[model samples]
Target: MENYKIPGHLRLETRRWAKKILEEYTLESHHFRMLVKTCEAWDRSEQAREALAADGLTVVDRYGTPKAHPCVGIERDSRTAFFRGLRELALDVDAPEVPRPPRTRDYGSRR
Candidate 1:
């Protein structure tokens, strides 16, 4: 059987959202592509930033400096929210609205 896998960040985010404490969401292909670009800016930082913004992600690094590169710094919680919203938006085929599931137990819960 072929082992299919989502990107690391995507998978982490998905698990995080499954737990809740995250509500609203907004994610688009353009945004995802922007993330890719941000992660690839080791050479062309300025160029990557311009391209990312054109693609649309509003990316900022941990240092609060304007990001000028491509990266996939998406954490667990945020990753899930982003992808969920992106999926919904794609399905709606008009204006993407992220569907919110009620809060649930955290990972390794016995509740």
Candidate 2:
């Protein structure tokens, strides 16, 4: 929808993606909100990744011990959020199959 404007705060790539999705899908108001949240998550993930790349994946703690960068977790969590939002928006290409529990033998039940 031309009337729906992508948020200016979003990164250029994120903006383009959001625009394409908006044009391609017939989304309700709630879906639009989800789209925005998804885009924000994508942007946040990208930002964290960039920071990680520049700073390296580890950082020295106060005790002089190397630990995982905070951005590492941020990137991971944001990526998860983005994907979850995509699923919520029904924009993912393939629907994830629900896992079914395996059947167990009833050894305790006497015939």
Candidate 3:
């Protein structure tokens, strides 16, 4: 089995997530690169979210008009990138077993 190290610079949560994914999956070299990019995007989204939480969601411009905080867009774009990477990884298809249905589903009835 090939050994891959998680990048040191990732945020705590992102590092944990990356570690878990690495442990759960056997990724090719290209897939490892994608995972690193995805982790970076996750960290970027988290950083933007933190900034948005510290600052208000909207900021006033020089004209005194309130506009969405720049971090809002950063967070949005980063989240999009992260999800796209996940789709490309196709982790769900590689899982060892099929996932159970959500508890909200009515397993007792046929619809």
Better of 1 and 2 by TM-score: 2
lDDT of 1 by residue, 1-111 (tens): 222222444334443432231123243445444443333322233344456557555556798876633422333333455455545335336653765555666745745
Cα-based lDDT for every prediction: 0.42, 0.89, 0.91
Better-scoring candidate (lDDT), 1 or 3: 3
Pairs of residues at least 3 apart in sequence or in different chains that clash in candidate 3: none
Superior candidate under lDDT, 1 versus 2: 2
Give the candidate order by descending TM-score: 2, 3, 1
Candidate 1 residue pairs that clash:
13-80, 37-70, 38-69, 38-70, 38-71, 39-70, 39-71, 40-70, 89-96
- Pick the lDDT winner: 3
Candidate 2, residues 1-111, lDDT tens digits: the string is 337778999999999999899888888887888999999999999999999999999999999999999999999999999989987887755565875456569755847
Question: Residue 66 in model 2: shift from native, Å?
Answer: 0.5
Estimated TM-score for each candidate: 0.19, 0.80, 0.80
* Model 3 local distance difference test score: 0.91
Q: What is the C-alpha lDDT profile of model 3 across 12-107, one tens digit per residue? A: 888898889989888998999999999999999999999999998999999999999999999999999999999889898755486756766667
Q: After superposing candidate 1 on the true structure, give the runs of residues whose Cα lies further than 4 Å from its correct spot.
A: 1-82, 90-101
Ranking by lDDT: 3, 2, 1
